[model samples]
Target: MKISNQNKTLDLTYPQVMGILNVTPDSFSDGGRFNHIDAALKQARAMIRDGATIIDIGGESTRPGAAQVSEEQEIARVIPIIEAIRLESDVWISIDTSKPQVMKRAVAAGADLINDVRALTVDGALDVAAQAGVPVCIMHMQGQPQDMQDNPQYCDVIDEVADFLNERIAQCIKAGIKRENIVLDPGFGFGKTMAHNFRLINQFNRFLDFKLPVLAGLSRKSMFDHLLSLKVDERLASSLTGALLCAQQGAHILRVHDVKETADMLKIMNTVASATH
Candidate 1:
């Protein structure tokens, strides 16, 4: 599959890495890491050198219980970084926001994709993405980030998530977003228990039936901590494990924090997978 964006189509011939760049002081996972333009530009180049095909920039912290940022604040934080990355490099850029206004401004500043955690349903979000003309990654979350994990439950987690993604994809199509510009995410760690996340990871390839590339954003997620009994700062090993597992499960894209490690793992796995075939 290929993601159509800005007169270019990103061919999904192998597992692609999307380095995470959060311009926030409260990203829950990597807060205060790259809030400045100089630091962010350096990190973005390093990821690209280390083999990241995409740079996903976000200003808001969608981590569980994160307070929302105003539209102006969100745009203020992310757009400049997006523009800086574009000015420095041409790596595919994904704006990780759900707000319609932010989406509009980010795209205008040169974002190649819209990674909407809300699946582009926030007030004017769908319309903004439709007008932006970029690849849209629709993700499934049980509720808003502020309370998503408060009591996330599912009688059948995988089926329900697939259903939600399917419906969201249909909605985007109905809203005039091209099918080739669509991707689906199971939303690991968004609003799921460890069991739910494990099941989704184990069965992620089932989503291929939707005919869109699958992206797995499980880096440093709580599931790794719950399974490995590690602190957030100590979960690198588990995060790499999940990234590798997701790639083996046929994930077309991996949204990750540790890009070099995941990129090295993908090099070996892709070589092995190809050799065997």
Candidate 2:
């Protein structure tokens, strides 16, 4: 499968890595590391060189209990980076925001995809995404970022997430967003408990029922902290393990931090699978 925006296309027949570029100062991991335009662009270049097909850029920190950022502030944080990257490379750029204005500006600056954690529920978001004519990744979050992880509850985690994503897909179609321009992210850590996250990864393929590309963004999440008591910098092994599990389950895109390591791991896995075939 492939998702395209204008002249750019990302083939999903094999899983693709989306390097995380958090341009915020408070993201749970790697925050403030790339807030400068040059730093951000440098990271983008490195990720691309390391085999990343997409760069998921975020201006706001969506970590639980995070402070909210205004639309102007968000645009200021991300637009320049987007413009700079566009000037150099044609790598797929994904704007990681829910604000319609930010979405509009990012696309204008050359973003190829919209990766909204709110699933375009924000007013004007649906319309903006539909009009942008780019691939949209609608993620399932149980609540707003400020309080999503306070105490997330689900009768059945897998079913509830699937139901939410299904509804969002229908909404996107109703809003005039074409089916081929949509991607689904089950949202591994948005509001999930440790068990909920593990269960979601194990049953990740359940989302295939919708027949849309599935994006798994479990890189260096707190779930690893809970599962193995590892610190943020120490979660590489666990993160790669989670990524491999999701890839084996047919994840089309893996939003990750360790681009080179994940790319190498996927290469080995693909090689072994090809040999077996």
Best by lDDT, which number? 2
RMSD of 2: 0.8
**Each prediction's TM-score against the native?**
0.98, 0.99
Estimate, for each residue in 1-277, the C-alpha lDDT of model 1 and write its tens digit: 7888766778898989999999999987889989998898899999999999999999999999999989999998998899888887889999999999999999999999999999998998988899998989999999899899987999999899999998998899999999978999999988899999999989988888888899999888888778778788787888888888788878999999999999999999978877964
lDDT values for all models: 0.90, 0.94
| Superposed Cα deviation of residue 226, candidate 2 (Å) | 0.9
Q: Candidate 2: which stretches are off by over 4 Å?
A: none
- Residue 213, model 2: lDDT of 96
- Each candidate's clash count: 0, 0
The Cα error of candidate 2 at residue 8, in Å, is 1.9
- RMSD for all candidates, in order, please: 1.1, 0.8
- Model 1 global lDDT (CA atoms, 0 to 1): 0.90
Task: Give per-residue CA lDDT, model 2, range 1-277, as digits (tens).
Answer: 8898888788999999999999999999999999999899899999999999999999999998899999999999999999999999999999999999999999999999999999999999999999999999999998888899999999999999998988999999999999988999999998999999999988989988888999999999999999789999999999999999999999999999999999999999999889965
**Stretches > 4 Å off in candidate 1:** none
